[model samples]
Target: MQFTFALFAAAALLTPVYSNEITPMSRRETGIKLESCTTSQQAVVEAAVQRAASLAKAAADAAINGDASIFEDGKVTYNCGNGTTQSDCGGNGVLAYALSGNNKIVNCPSWYKIVPAIDDCGGTDQGLAMVHELSHMNEVYSPPTQDFAYKYNDLVQLPTEQAVLNADTYNLYAGAIDLGCQVGESKGVVLPDWMVTEIMNNNSK
Candidate 1:
């Protein structure tokens, strides 16, 4: 389910004036590449990779190709370095890094077969929580999209401190994917409202 906004005078009016957290020319040059992954890690990466590819293709079809969704299967690879600057399963500051060189989203935790730790609630799929970082990758080259996502994320998590707690990273990516679609909808791109609902639902999770 993808959402797109209608392009109109509202576009200029509704478009958010993003902040410095994102710069269109900015590039995330630092981070580790994922060369390999365990069965579990591979599953997670495969799911995210497929979804990302689908979204990227949708964006292109809608003509919103703002460089927000350019990732693909072949363009992506993995690195198995664990506890060495790159690794999911909570081994370092960042589990994965989506580099700007070729719009590659690196799966840092390629070594770990399973996610190391869960959230405070013992949630699954929360281990390699690189969704936020991947969002940053999409926004790194798209400043407006980043600003829009950050603001939307804050709004979504504002209802509870628990939601925002330790949410600095998580919310950003979720917001990017969510609001990116929402913004697209408002820009005249044809997307479904269900997509927006899914994004909202995911953000709450």
Candidate 2:
């Protein structure tokens, strides 16, 4: 149920020009390494990782003076493989995953898009999905937990304590900032500025 937006030009005009108040994290800073993926896939991975890092940085800046406490060190290796053979592939609509103890590695399916479009707040793209995976890495969240609040609906209703830990919360927060809109706008569950403010407020408390 992925929604595609063919409004890149319109989106570009709507996308905010993020300031340099806090330097955004780069792919190198994130330490994301791709294996067994095509050159085009690698490029998409790079973009996705960079996007996640920048969004994470933005969240940190807005929440706690650019303190990226969860992103301790972005050292994760991504391996592309067939969905059928890989564990956690295509389960419950999951796009990627990090094994329990081997949190340094993320398994992505071969069918994973090389260049997924920028998602509206209602839907997810590869970039947003990768952000969800990043949140599971030990380097991102120490003692990485398995309880990720999935989908837009769960993200909005998440309690403060759970919202701070849920991977999808981070994804939606990033998406909210990237799209400059409320979460679930397309799904008709609009909460004005909820994603941007709620998580930051929770972190502040």
For each candidate in the order shown, give its overall lDDT on alpha carbons: 0.34, 0.52
Model 2 regions lying over 4 Å from their true place: 1-29, 68-74, 82-92, 143-145, 183-189, 192-205
TM-score of candidate 2 versus the correct structure, residues matched by position: 0.67
Clashes of 1: 21
Best by TM-score: 2
For residues 105-177, write the lDDT of model 1, one tens digit per residue. Answer: 5555432333443322212132224333443443232321222223233434433333222223233323234
Error of 1 at 138 (Å): 6.2
Measured over all alpha carbons after superposition, the RMSD of each candidate to the real structure, in angstroms, is 13.2, 8.8
Instruction: Judging by lDDT against the true structure, name the best candidate.
Output: 2
Clashing pairs in 2: none
